[model samples]
Target: MSDILKFPKDFYFGSATSATQSEGTFEGDGKGQDIWGKWFELEPEKFYNEVGPYKTTTMYKHYKEDIQLLKQTGHNSFRTSISWARLFPEGHGEVNEKAVAYYRDYFETLRENDIEPFVNLFHFDMPAALQDIGGWENRKVVDYFKEYAKTCFELFGDVVKKWFTFNEPIVHVEMGYLHQYHYPMKVDAALAVKVGYHTALASAYAIKEFKKLKTGGKIGIVLNLSPAYPRSNNEADLKAAEIAEAFQNKSFLDPAIKGEFNPLLIELIKKHDLMPDYDEKDLDVIKENTVDFLGVNYYQPVRVKARDSVPNPDAPFLPTYYFDIYDMPGKKMNPYRGWEIYEKGIYDIALNIKNDYGNIEWMITENGMGVQDEDRFKKDGMIEDDYRIDFYKGHLKWLHKGIQEGSNCVGYQVWTPIDCWSWLNAYKNRYGLIELDLETQERTIKKSGYWFKDLHDNNGFEL
Candidate 1:
């Protein structure tokens, strides 16, 4: 076992959380309303169990204790996003000094505990004021985001060396404009293209600005890359999977890493006549400001097959117009979260990066299984999350294989440190090393948490 599955000594082990999901004070401490806060007020039924951002784990007040818990779980590094509205109340001009002080103290405390902080600028929470003007749709929001990135660098550049421009930028386009899961729920394909373009452009702008600071730190964007697999080797099915990969994965990955759009994706966009308006300058910005590293957040692979019927010409364009998601028979699934558990998907992603794109420095920024009714697993004083342990081991085994094959993978960070409020899922599915009792905000390390500590200490575990 020692000779078979050992991890590199320098390979980082940690977990990740976003500000909106973990920090409870959405409207307090001069934090202007984010889209989540406003959306809850507008439509309370949209969230599960009627839980909102205001009732999260209260990481704002309990960050010190939380960091201690992170250390207890064997996290040598942790990633969290900075709330844009928390820093700039209106999303543009004045800096919220209180929020600044809180983040500074938060980073300092993490550093004091010997845990590195991987700070991200934006998650899904857009400032409501910005959304009013047009969140990622309007080009002006891109400039505002660039300014916000600069402010974070000026303030936290001394301690925070690892920075990410955005977390899952594609979600804003796919969920908001296409699937209608996010705020400003519109199903316009053209509008989705515009939002996606502006998001990739904004990431480049942020990277350019971050480099200008000369902070001697690395910066990149976090992308959720789910490899699209065809249902069969048939030509039609392979074409469907190719289109899915182009739209979902390469749309952001190409621009961030390759500094260009995939030609196949561009061809599809043009064929559908959903091309976004852009100028030479925006193209130049994207081409010139490629990222220094990459962050991958992979959960499951998407299976696709050719559409049974042709799309109506008069109807609005959709990505699924060319293909349909195929549920592979006999696929293993996480019963609670309902996501497929194909561990080899991690190896596929790593090899894709190594062989197709240059093997750039990268890390598993987020990967974990979320379980519903997790209380059922509680045993003794802690939750006996043996399933969660198995989940990690399966993924790690493949990830170790990738590393052995010269994939240049850097670290592994789970989706969360503690069970906190998910976006629309709220508390329905819990994915954390530590369980948080929402009533008392009490945190107790789960059995998986203890097991992870030993893995971190040993640098590997027996399979």
Candidate 2:
């Protein structure tokens, strides 16, 4: 290991987490219920071990201690989201001053500790109040979101220099509308189209509002970009791969970064009569406001192939009508999460952004391996997760190459910092640098945490 992979001096190193995922006291201190809270109430069985958001890592009460752990784990920067429901209990009108004060203190604490805070506005936790009124499906809720964004900027803009409008905007579309995995689950293709469109529109409106206040902060959206690879070079396989990329990757990327919707996607929606209701005003908003930078979360690539079986014409529509997921034989697997592990996928994603998107400034916002029953690997009070360190090294090698080739990639933030309650999956899969003892609510740094500290201090590591 003589040759060290030295990153640029300015490259940021940190971990990412979300408010709903880390903050346990959801109902106290003027915090209102978000969609997750309501969903857990209605269908508790859907969640792993019946462990809902309420059983998280208690960041609200333990933020100070948590921030110390962040520093100890060698985070020069960190990403977390603000709960909209916490700020506006009803998602509109009067603001909750407690929420305001809490966030201000949170951001200031990070700044005081020499850790930059990258705050995101929405992270799949919609206000329960907003959901009762159709959520993203109704155009009215878009305006409500704009107001919420404006309020967040007015309150915390000074302390937070980096802000994101939303995280993984496509997940809501795919889960809530197309698949039945999320709340208000409805398997409707047209509604999926509508939801996806309004999400983009809402993000643009937030960007527009952020600029209006002149906060002097950089605003962007966090997207989980999974590159699509064809199983073979056949024309049908290529076509399948293209459509998968269009729907999953570019749906939000083009509008958020390029300030325009992909015409090919529009054509597909139109062909299926799934076109969403929209007007010129929203289009103008999207066109005028593109992101200042991009936050990418890449877990795995989507392997696609031509649909072998004809779909029943009578059946309802789906984005997969033109293509289907192809499972390549003998691919490496992260058995805990059942996700394929292809380190080179990160490289392909970086190169695509460099050549196609003008190499816009970006960072690896979320990338880490999730393991189940992690205690099985615990040794001498620390979880020996060498697999996680290897995972990071493999991905970082490609990321470093991307930067060397002139891609404007600035940072690498793992999926999370402290082990916390995850959505639906609960604690089934752990992706934390520090282990959280759920029973005692104690925090212990893991082996990877120490490895990360050294890597951050050295600005790189031996390959």
Error of 2 at 435 (Å): 0.4
Error of 2 at 195 (Å): 1.0
When superposed on Cα atoms, how far off is each prediction in RMSD?
1.1, 0.9
TM-score of 2: 0.99
Clashing pairs in 1: none
Model 2, range 1-463, lDDT digits (tens) per residue? Answer: 3889999878899999999999876555898889999999999999998988886988998899999999999999999999999998898988889888889999999999999999999999899999998898988988999999998898888999899999999998999988888888889888888888999999999999999999897999999999999999999999999999999999999999899998889999999889888899889999999999999999998999999899778888887899989999999999989999999988888899999997898999999999998999999989999999999999999988888888888899998899978888999999999999999989999999999999899999997
Model 1 RMSD in Å is 1.1
Candidate 1: residue 150 Cα off by (Å):
0.4
lDDT by residue (136-158, candidate 1, tens digit) is 98999999999999999999999
* Residue 201 lDDT (model 1): 92
Global lDDT for candidate 1? 0.92
Runs of candidate 2 with Cα error greater than 4 angstroms are none
lDDT of each: 0.92, 0.92
